[model samples]
Target: MIRVNHRSGGVLVLAVTETRLTAAVAPQFKQLVLDQIEAGNTRLVLDLSEVGFIDSTGLGAMVGILKRVGSRGDVAVCGLQPAAAQMFRLTRMDKVFRIYDDADAAVGALEQS
Candidate 1:
């Protein structure tokens, strides 16, 4: 479901491999990411380059993940496809999460934080 990569300065990059992030997989996706957060990976960059569709459930899952991190850490989103980007904008999640063009840029920003 996700390709996990550990970068320098304690940033965890989670690249979603699925094309659609909807009700069917949002729960599992949320659980997997929450597990990572519980495992001491607080800084995160969620790469959604492969995800072309995101429903309300998927957005909810992302919000849940961010809430899980809270003030203890940060979660940034990157590599959003056009549809996903539009969804984020329409939902105003663009303001809630830092959006980056790529994983490397997101990692750099989180590393600095």
Candidate 2:
């Protein structure tokens, strides 16, 4: 099961599970993010520490979420497991998103930036 945790640092941390985020769950994920944004909480940090894997749909969903947050707000990622991290690197999304070692570090950096 996939679970999303809205953290106190004002980051909507989506701690995914179940190995992969496919089309079946991408829309729901996107909607959750949109709901957060509409609630005036725009800063987001996807905590992929628990996600062992992610497919193209998952990556696309993340990109879509980032776009929704826009340049006006901060959207970051951190604590990616090895398999997921490899996928991010392979896709070169590592350059697209601000990835950190941990959630606290990401939140702090976002606050400063």
Candidate 3:
């Protein structure tokens, strides 16, 4: 299951709770995130602390979300568990998205960028 917790303060934080972010579920999650981004939201922080794994589809979903926000906005990820964090590193996505230890750090990174 995937759960996105939305927060304010010029930053929209999405907390994902799922064993895997694979093709089976990435699309739905992508749409949900897209909806949030389109709703006048600019800064975003995706918290993957509870997500145990992420497949290529999940990576693609994140890339799509980043594109949706574009350079006009910023999107960072936080709290990625070890497994998911490894995948990001393997795919070089860790370099793509600004990653931090927690939501506050991500928000700070984005604000500073």
Candidates' C-alpha lDDT: 0.96, 0.79, 0.84
lDDT of 3 by residue, 10-48 (tens): 777887767788899899888888888888777889888
Q: Estimate each model's TM-score.
A: 0.99, 0.85, 0.89
| Candidate 2 positional error at 54, Å | 0.5
Per-residue accuracy of model 2 over 1-113 as CA lDDT, tens digit each: 44666666566666565566677777887787778788887887777776777889989989988888887688889888888889889999999999999878887887776
Best-performing candidate as measured by TM-score = 1
Residue pair clashes in candidate 3: none
Q: Pick the lDDT winner.
A: 1
> lDDT ranking from best to worst?
1, 3, 2
Candidate 3's C-alpha runs over 4 A off are 1-8
